[model samples]
Target: MKVRTDAKRDEILEIARGVFLELGYERASMAEISTRVGGSKATLYGYFPSKDALFLAIVNRLAEQYVLPATERLEQSLDEDPRVALQRFGEQFLTFISDAEAVAAYRVVVSEAAHSDIGESFYESGPKRTVESVARYLEGAMDRKHLRRADPAIAAQHLLALLAHGEPWHQYFLRKAPSPTRAQIKRIVERALDVFLNGYKS
Candidate 1:
């Protein structure tokens, strides 16, 4: 017989996220998680066999919750004017970093990647997917003569690097500065596009 969960999976995931964020994939203890969730480790184990299983669930959840939608938005905007397309993309990318919880999750991933294999998979599924999707868009625009000719992957990386030096990375890693005003984001994305397309446009 199929068994329904006696305890809510969402509730466990919610508490588990705090535990993983605070303690990270390596240092977090099941006993501590069980305590936080008001369950014995044995009960927690019934739901999640090991710390790694719980951590992996969080990683997979993050990719599903954040990354896929961001990429889908970009893919759907391929027909927009190149500048408008880029601007929309920039805004979506920026939103991920500016939100406090998303920023926190990213920082946690950065820290954990130094220690675990799961981190590598998470990077592939999320940030790496984002970079690839951006590159494919650049490639498509280049093919359509809407943008410049260049290696899409390299072009995409360059754009991301440019974006990073500005508000998102700064605000993500540095301090609780004010979110970048829309004017600031538009200006940078515009200037970056100008520089890039100037060199690549054929």
Candidate 2:
């Protein structure tokens, strides 16, 4: 048996991302991914047991590469003005979720949700993680008297919900509009931060 290397796994994931993007989850095939990766189907299966697993891995990878790190920065910057830090986080989170690749992955998850566990898996791996991260940050802020005492998890949910308010999120999910522009996102973040701080300020 051949030993699996991180390099080989990453290479396979890279090819798989492009293939998945080009053909989409329902249509993309392991054989095609293996061909692009210069590997056998067995090798592909060795790395990822099934197509769903591969797709989930790709989604999680993208989240880790983009979302997690950005949130980590938010946590690290907690000493900054709470409003400023939260505005930055809100903008970052909205921007990350509105990316084309992220939206595509979200569509794939929604499409497969009824038939498979992929949707639940995505929630656990992606959005849940982001929520938990923000919750932690909020908890810390509460402890420091940056915000009034409240349920951090609920506070985190409120923050995200406010950030996602209005037509940009709704219209995009409905396929009626494109991702929000930087200026639009900035306005949204500013408005959300105003409401959030007013409600939570210690």
Candidate 2 deviant stretches above 4 angstroms:
165-167
Clashing pairs in 2: none
- In terms of lDDT, the poorest run of 10 residues in model 2 is 165-174
Best by lDDT: 2
How much lDDT does candidate 1 score? 0.73
lDDT of 2 by residue, 25-132 (tens): 878999999988887999999999999999999999998888898789888877888888887777877888888888888889999999999999999998888889
> Candidate 1, after superposition: displacement of residue 7 in Å?
8.9
**Residue 161 Cα positional deviation in candidate 1, in Å, after optimal superposition:** 1.9
Q: Please report, in order, the local distance difference test score of every candidate based on alpha carbons.
A: 0.73, 0.87
Estimated TM-score per prediction? 0.77, 0.94
lDDT by residue for model 1 (67-182), tens: 56766777677688877777777766665556666666666667767777657866776668878988988888888888767889998888777665543577556687766777
Model 1 pairs in collision: 148-200, 148-201
